[model samples]
Target: MKRNSLLLLWLFIFWSVLIWSAIDPKDYPTWFLEVFPALIGFVVLAATYRRFSLTPLVYLLILIHAIILMVGGHYTYAEVPLGEWMKEWFGLARNDYDKIGHFAQGFVPFMIAREIVIRNKVFKSRGWMHFFLLCFVMALSAFYELIEWWVALLSKEAAAAFLGTQGYVWDTQSDMFFALIGGLCAWVLLTKLHDRQLREL
Candidate 1:
């Protein structure tokens, strides 16, 4: 399909999901907290569309990530039906959809970071580029955790749902760990594909 058509489709899907998420969510505050990132992301992409168009792969990944956020927003991550089902099926202690979000947190940003590095010629060495990419993703994950902490401190009613920690003591650390792993996997799995797309662009 043409790029414009694809982008139109992406926007349609995003708005559709956003509207669905906004309708009688479990709680408005929790929904706002959860969906805020996706909204911010959409604004950023739209603002940068002319000057910093991303690869189709990156756009699709962003859409998937936004959908995850919206779904989590609508149901609250800890109580998402899919996560609950997975918890039962896997005999896990908590709904792990939040973990999936964390993983994507690293996964998607790594591509964005990698594209910037390559496009801007930020690093001379591939090794250094990869190292810097990992560092950037780790820092982003930590910052998001801090945002969650601040949100929790400010709003008791929305804290549990927003945090989605699900009583795990190592939630913060594990979230960053999963993000790191996700970044590593993205590097290994998507680098060549991303490189091809970058070349095309």
Candidate 2:
């Protein structure tokens, strides 16, 4: 199949699932709101699909990240079924799947930035690239936290569901920290892989 066609197919599947999830009564209101970014990202990517050829690994990562968001939306993060089950099995205090989602929010975006930087040759300084990538992920996380705060101010109940703190006093701090960790991990894991993918492209 043509690359553009494949991209369209993937997008169609994503949106179909999203539309279904949006109307599903079992999902929390925050679920749809949380998915807003991914939906927007899809539209942006689709618009540029013909001009870009992303690595299969990057596509897989994006899909995984989207699924994480969808799952969090469905269960309101703190009460995610899988996380709650894991918590019970491991005897933890609360569900931690939301952490995973937030981490990927940074992790996946790290590769997206890396792809853009390498593909565009945005900067000549390799060390600075990594530094800027870390800073970028942190800034993104902080901005998201602010968004959460704003949502809380506007709609306390819905925002509580969106925050998905699960009783952690340092939820916001930990979210950013995990995102930082994920950014580092993405750099470590995808740097060489992305280089290889770039060569193939």
Candidate 3:
């Protein structure tokens, strides 16, 4: 598809999901907390669109990440129907949707960071660039966990849905672990393709 058309479609899907997510979500506060990042991302993308046109791959990934966040916001990660089904089918302790979100937290951001570093010629060594990307994403995940902690301390009711710990003792650790895995996976699977796209730019 043409770049403009594809971007238009992405924007349409984003707004459509945002609207659906906002309609009688599980709770206003939890929904806001969950979707706030996506909203902020939209603004950032718009502001940077002309000055910094990203590769189509990155844009598509961002849209996917946004959709994930909006869906989680709509149902709260613990109560999402797909996660609930998986929970029952797998006989797991709790829904794993939140884990997927956290993974994407690492997955998408690392790509964004990777693209920025590569396009800007920020790093000379490929090894160092990849290492820095993983570290950056892990730090991002840890900061998000701290944000959850702060939110929980401030509002008990909103925290459970926002945290989505589901009684796991090592939820925070596992969350960052998943993010680390995501960063590694993205690098392993997409680095060549990302490089191609950057070359095209």
Candidate 4:
């Protein structure tokens, strides 16, 4: 019962943040671009809950990612207040909240992919599994950059906010690099805990 209540609370918080994000954003299109993945994730989780429920750590990470998405949607990544605060405090070149989003993009998805791969016994060799994971995460990261490019071309009005490039010529490249780093770090930092959780699951 307590576990069920906690799950409900988790859902309530997600919906609350999503609603707040949707009420009024920096721009409607940019909001959709950012929040769409969270919406898809919610659907996928619901669909798989009974037959293939993920580990609690994965679920928690997904929620955190969704919250990051919604927050970025509400303010647009370049103008996020938290990122702005950090930028000023640290004397940085630009708001880097988008980097957080990119990092989570790699980190959370790598966990999900690793869980799915391990649970299914997809690779006989650990080395091969790691290789596949790196490829998958990097591909995902690069594809997302392509998405930003395509979207920028489609909607000039929302391009700047949605892309969150902030006049940096290498923003897209850096985003992918951060994602690669995130993926590598996640594998190093999370493999042990994730393996324990997999045993429990």
Tell me model 3's lDDT, rounded to 2 decimals.
0.95
Worst 10 residues of 2 by lDDT: 20-29
Residue-by-residue lDDT tens digits, candidate 1, 15-130: 99999999999999999999999999999999999999999999998999999999999999999999999999999999999999999999999998888889999999999999
Which structure is stronger by lDDT: 3 or 4?
Answer: 3
Say which prediction, candidate 2 or candidate 4, comes out ahead on TM-score.
Answer: 4
Model 4 segments beyond 4 Å from truth? none
Measured on C-alpha atoms, candidate 4 has an lDDT of: 0.92
Model 3 agreement with the true structure over 60-168: per-residue lDDT tens digits:
8999999999999999999999898998999988899998998999999999999999889999999999999999999999999999999999999899999999899
| TM-score of candidate 2 relative to the true fold | 0.90
| Candidate 4 Cα RMSD (Å) | 1.2
Per residue, candidate 4 scores C-alpha lDDT tens digits across 63-101 of 999999999999999999999999999999999999999
Ranking by lDDT: 3, 1, 4, 2
lDDT of each: 0.94, 0.83, 0.95, 0.92
Let me know the TM-score candidate 1 reaches against the reference structure: 0.98
